[model samples]
Target: MSSLVSFFAGAFIGGVVAYIFSRRVANVQFDNAKTRDKSQKKRYKDIYIRASNQRLSLGPYIVAIGGGTGLSTLLKGLKCFTRNITAIVTVTDEGGSSGRLRQEWGVLPPGDIRNCLLALAEDDSSLNRLLNFRFDRGELAGHSLGNLLLLAATEIAGDFRKGIEELNYMLAIRGQVLPVTTESVCLVGRTKNGSRVEGELNITTCGPDLEELWLEPRNAKPLPEVLKAISNADLIVLGPGSLFTSVIPNLLVEEVSNAILNSSAPVVYVCNLMTQPLETEGFSVWDHAKWIAKVLRRFPDFVVANSTPLPQDIASRYIAAGSMPLLVTPEEREKFKKIGVYLIEDKLYKINEEGSVRHDSVKLAECLVRIARSAREREIWKESIQFSGMSG
Candidate 1:
């Protein structure tokens, strides 16, 4: 009897311990499930928001020409307005990871192109951060992952354009980004002192006023697609970038300049917020317009400039760096009007995330849309008058 009782007690204790263990495990699993559901709900919310934002993107077909952070900044803002955007980027870059790649693998500089791609990417925030990441150590030091990715894709696709296409599909970019040309072009500038400065990097710090800018291989044919974009665009935008290296270099291509002049689409030049050191040290709004007119032989229909003053802290920093806001005098405004270029000035600048004074993308986009809409309205009114006259 004693043996039987002892065996029964042990069995009861073992069963109770196992039951307690199972209950603890069940509780933990239930908590884990709740956490996963919460994560899924947040992700779903993000997707819903992105989808809703894109519904209002049927604004206009805009073509933006230029390069560097300024061009990309404009692109980032413009995407919110329209899905039909074509960014024509200058590829004369000779600095940073792009410079190294061009020197080693003999490819067109990828830095600016990469930036344009990220700017127009559908998943702008996350992918932009990823592509802009730079390695700090080892052989990859100072190299941008986006530049490397472009280089590899180019090699794999056997051409740069094809590689860009592949990335476009993978990233679901909002609009197209095209190089001005496929040839490895060099930016050459003639300083006012009659000294010649070659290469994009050297021209910026050449310490002289640039009087003329040109590209090597003067006969370089533009990518046919770029011409098509300009011809079909409702509006074309120029500048808000490096005056010599970015904006002028594109015009140096004879065919590209001709396309802009021939197209009925109105051309608008988005002037920079401040004069660059050594390039446009004391440039005013008129100076910027005249230089562009001199090269293209036709003035832009509209010139958009910032009318807002910079914050004192920001102004001081730029002043110390030998830069200042571009002044558009009343006389200059009248002169531009006499020459048929409408001056659209607004408070279009702000301190960007990096704490630098730059064009506010949304504000700039708003200004552009306003001009484009007004132009469209005028055209419609003219057509209506013609129709009424004929019917009468």
Candidate 2:
């Protein structure tokens, strides 16, 4: 009993010391973050030139269409490579904290869009802090300050795209972000084998049996700017998001899919790290590719796959949550090979001690630049062949 008492006393003292140190560290970090924000404003003013000041070049343009964390994660990295980027995000989400805001106010949910904007913002910028600010209590306890700002802007501007444009200006964001559709839309999903699910969150987490997903607003129109962005892009990126919800919803717009097929740009699909039980249940990387291609009138020119193996410990945690790392199948690789689609193999995931699988943004972005450059070479080759044939 005496030994046990002494051990407990020692542990308590050590824990108390650790807690105090942690709080002090946190305070220091907060101060540093504030200082960083102050300096960023001056930096942007010095560097970000107006359209007239920008150098004119016919360089490649990239359009990334999708919503949710996956798409934002990709954007966080992609922006590092090229300044000409366009993100066409989904607005059909109506669940969780985002759902409550959508109900209380008849405006597009701001959760996903807010995330995309922050992802494109300069690291430690004040704009990111403002956008991520959340209420601490009351009816707005769970609402994000950014969501309220977006709602106010949408109502005042009388246009959702215009609202985002203003926010972009304030943030000095690197890329352009647009909604998939302007009409308020909801996601409705049905299981592959059976059952119907409604609402984006419900459909995404309901089960591993989803067969198809559709938007509620059947007459929803694609934003003209989104279509224009796609048509002029030199490359388009789809996926690395909820296969149906984030990815397919954008493609569901007839004009959006048509733009992909018609554009003289390479299409690349970034496969997910794992299958979401409620959405992509039982899907392989190839299954995801096939389903997305089904929606696209033309197939992709390149596919980026996680050649890295996920840690078993992290996999166990995911299994407990009813999800698993998406495994690539041999047949799928062969199929892609037959179709002339190049598969990029790389270690892009880092399983932290906390058991969360995060995309190594730097690695993924670096890989994207290399692959994109290679795709450009291939495009040159194809165009050369066409010219040669014409001469013959």
Candidate 3:
């Protein structure tokens, strides 16, 4: 009996020692795994940073011109491709929060500017939410937080342009947003009935076919920075926004049009997905391009148009709202070919969750990047040929 008890004691001691040793080994392995995970994470972060910096330096410089959601949408997509983007926004906004701020503060409308700024924001952060916030009551009722912020920023910086610069720096924005002009001006339109309407709000709401459209201050000069951006751009894009109010207003600035004409870069126009109720009722894609060419006295080298069909339900909704899909008829297409404009049509639009038609930003950006790449290849090929000829 004494020998058996001694044997049992020995077994218990051995079991405890074995368990403790295994536990220590497991803990050491776990510690090593954690350290390796951290190291891997850091390495990935470093690589991403380096890659982003490399793309920023090597990407082609692109200038996108328009206003409202269209320009912002383009910017959102293009930022994924290149950090070197310049958004030239129109300044003729005279409705909603922008109009109210303009009347009360005597400043250029901030509504469009705010949208561009948020679109170019590096991330969807608290600042973006703060800028998009809106007031529901009191003196600030119906005012957008971004418009008020821009107004305050203008006051703090002592100049509208400087205010934008400060905001851009604070946001670490991926690209630059420039107003088409600094002068405070209203959009004017003439009805086919020989009546004149002023202010963008009145003009759009008039519900009549517009005979002509112009700015209140006909000679509103384009900003020098805008001209410089155009001159330096590898590619220039126009529109995908309201044809008369958003797109053409930028071209109304004489210097802006001239710069576009003089620039060696290829100019591309993004046609709207649908005809706007009052602004572009019964219009076709060709009508939009024709109007643009008429206003600028020149046509774009290319037009990016949507070839996607809307879902049945979404199509019904738009039709109910009196909007129609902008179709590119065969005759109009021939017109584009005759004018030396390349019409690149693709599945460029989609219905968002809100049931509104929106351009696929990523897809659009891809097309623009492809075009830029092709342009570069052409440039290189031309240079090589010239060098060979000279040497020969």
Candidate 4:
């Protein structure tokens, strides 16, 4: 009876302790549940806000390299997501309106940069018409309105970077427009026949095919900010511009390539939709990648290439001009894969009524936003990273 009493007393004490511990555990679980619920609600709200402000986040240190309308078009798409796009445009545009401006003003080439800025400008700004308007008569016959603005601004600021800053505010632009170099840069092309051409336009006239295109000054200094932007960019885009004049010219700047090679950011090359006659005649997807990779010292990680085929009739039209459809064959993809280049094949071609290739701006923009968001997610661990969904 004494042993039985002892056992019963022990069992009773044990049960009491168990009951207290269980109550404490239950209280903690309940509090935790409440906290989780609160956190979930807050998370949902943040997602909602991010979705609404999706475009705004894209405004952080995004840099675009290359020149011409291709670079400008990309800027148009990028600006939709974030105002923070910095364009390091090529000044080797020695064609039509741009060429004339460079010759007459004795100023840095501003035509391509001007177009890029206008593309990023908020709608209905005075900066638009003022910069793009054309003159029909006078000594200024063919000069674009934007080129004049830049020239005037350059003169006033006594610096190209300063002019771009002033214009950025007035236009409510998302980022700064920087020249590849403040020094006057001329495009140099060495033909397969051993003939050397001195200007971007001259290269077009010189050839059935190009051997190599380089920059004069051989030691062109890259804009300091351009170098900084490349160093800090989460992403760098090479182009859909003229392969020789617009794209390669920037890379030829020794400092520009060095900065890009040093950056931890992924470099994406937006391949042109159509082959250009003189510069990239008969060039294929792999051809473009090979040339660019070799020149820049490292192949691009991602190539956003066009997979859409041109209509036979349109293809014929291009063929007449000695241009070929840019084929992204399996072999071509493999060639790129041999290097660090990965292919992002998508239908991003929009042909104008004039039967010329154009960029699918909306699709391209969507791709860029997706890339940025995914990159951010990977950078920040899920425990704290919140994604802003599409606002539109």
Candidate 5:
């Protein structure tokens, strides 16, 4: 009985020791597994980051010139293709919250720049909603939070360009936004009836019979950085915005236009989706391209127009508003061919939930990327030919 008791007690102690040892071993294995999982996750993360950086670095350097919703829309799409984008925005806005800020704060218009920044932002959805918030009451009535932020940034940085750069980093935007010029200037236009129109608002609203448009303070200089960007661009895109208000104003700065003319990059003109009531009332795609050529002093290498037909209901609404779709006709294609300009038409339109027609960002971007790639290939071939000639 004594031997039995001793043996049973000894067995119970040994079993406890074995159980404890097993538990320790299991815990150590679990910890090792967790460590390996964390290390593997980190390694994958590093690889993804490196690849993303390489892709962005290898993207073609594209410079987009315009302002307003059109420029922002284009930026939204372009950011997906390349991080090497420079948005050169028009600063002659003299209306809305931007106008008020310009008049009151004595700063260049921030509305367009703000829009471009948001469009290229890393996380646009949340940031856009926050910055685009408008105050409907009190002293800040009719002003956007974004404009105020830009104003504050400008004040803090002590220079408009520096302020914009600061916001570029703060927003973690995919590309940079630059004002066409930092100097304060007004958009001036002359009507076909010889009536002089001053300011972007008057020029846009006065009539579509605008015979001439120029910037006030005639010698307003283009930003040096803007000129450099144009010089280094692999592709330059103009428009898809209001012709007189958003696009032409930038070209009015002689140096900017000159830079574009001299650049080896392929230039593309993105025609607007629809005509504005008083601005482009009866304009067709050809008319739009003609105006651009008139200002640019050269026809763009390519013209991208939407080929998608609008829904009848949507068309009716636009018609009622005195705006019509800017369609590319067969005649326009022949005209473009004569000018040595390639005409690229695609199903680029999308109807939002609100029933308003806009460009399909992804589709438009993809088209532009393809054009850039083609241009790049042609450039390489040309260079190779030159090299072979030198070798021979």
Candidate 6:
């Protein structure tokens, strides 16, 4: 009986010892996990702080002019380089959901502005998809949710410009977007044959070469903020978009064009990747630059052109759709140089899985930043030289 009692006591002591060891081990594991988590958090905090500092101190003031996917694409790339960006969007859209909204609500077209806002949003992955959601099989068919939200915002704010400002804040976008003009204006194109075409859609679709382009009323004033942005900009960029419809429409606003010309900032023009049917058919890089010069009344300081060739399948697809790549020849490069415009050529294109081509945004932004730095240095040197000469 005594032996049985001793065996039971030993078993009980063993169970107690095992429990205590397990509890100690669990406590050690918990402490280690806590330390690891704290270390990871510190690392994340350090990264965030560094990124914030770079954005604040390293970014330059830039004013980008144009409208359409081209401007949005550029914005997507540019926001990575600078927080001080002002996008001057053309307001003469007369087709698609923007057209419908304009006609129905009498508001400025929100499509391009929405796109720019999305491109600059802090977290655009889910929001981009959500806002770009289109409806079908209802009265809302063919209208994007973003357009509707912008329309609603305009109604709530009781002013178009105010509404846009509200959205700029609400979306927490990296930069500002301004319409070239707040007034209701129509695009009018005078064909080389002396025929007048009215509306952006018709003009883009019109077969004849455009000899002249102007805004209706001929006195559309620019937004005051646009001029201020131009005056404050360290660099100005124009066009990777349609020449007549997207880029030139802003220039047609006399005050906007004059401000751009008067600003001390150096202007750079990004040439289109492919020639659009009827709009820029058979046009070379020089041809695009010449048109911009004609409208701006002076040549841009630099022209960024893509020198990379498209894949065979993509090239064939684009050709089939009546579009061709804009090739820059050696002769054209010499012509640009003669005109005092620097030609920047590089492999600046990317082809999507669906055979669509676009400028590689990150690569393009890096190039623009490099150009801005060089231009700023040159300006400083020139100023210093002039000061020295005066002192002497």
The lDDT values for all models are 0.84, 0.76, 0.84, 0.77, 0.88, 0.86
User: Lowest summed lDDT over 10 consecutive residues: which window, candidate 5?
Assistant: 383-392
TM-scores, all models, native as reference: 0.83, 0.78, 0.87, 0.78, 0.89, 0.90
Model 2, 247-364: lDDT tens digits are: 8888877778887888877788888888887567777887788777777855677777776567777788888897878755677778888887767666778765776897777677
Number of colliding residue pairs in model 2: 3
Query: What stretches of model 2 exceed 4 Å from their correct place?
Result: 1-59, 124-126, 190-196, 205-208, 351-355, 374-392
Candidate No. with top lDDT: 5
Count steric clashes of candidate 5.
0
The lDDT of model 5 is 0.88
lDDT of 5 by residue, 1-392 (tens): 99999999999999999999999999999999999999999999999978886797788888999999999999999988889999999999988899999999999999999999999998899999999999999999999999999999999999999999999999998879999999999999888899888988888886468888899899999988999999988889997799999999999999999999999888889998999998888999998888889988988888889877888989999999999988888888888888778777777789889888888887777777766766676654222322111111
- Candidate 6 accuracy as TM-score: 0.90
Best of the two (2, 6) by lDDT: 6
Candidate with top TM-score is: 6
Question: Candidate 6: where are CA atoms >4 Å away?
Answer: 2-14, 17-32, 35-43, 46-50, 378-392
Ranking by TM-score: 6, 5, 3, 1, 4, 2
Q: Give the TM-score of candidate 5.
A: 0.89
How many collisions between residues are there in candidate 1?
A: 0
Per-residue CA lDDT of model 6 for 217-277, tens digit only, reads 7998888999999998888999789988899899889988899899888798999999999
Using alpha carbons, what is the TM-score of model 1?
0.83
Q: How many backbone clashes does candidate 3 have?
A: 0
Candidate 3, residue 279: lDDT: 77
Which TM-score value belongs to model 2?
Answer: 0.78
> Which 10 consecutive residues of model 4 have the lowest summed lDDT?
383-392
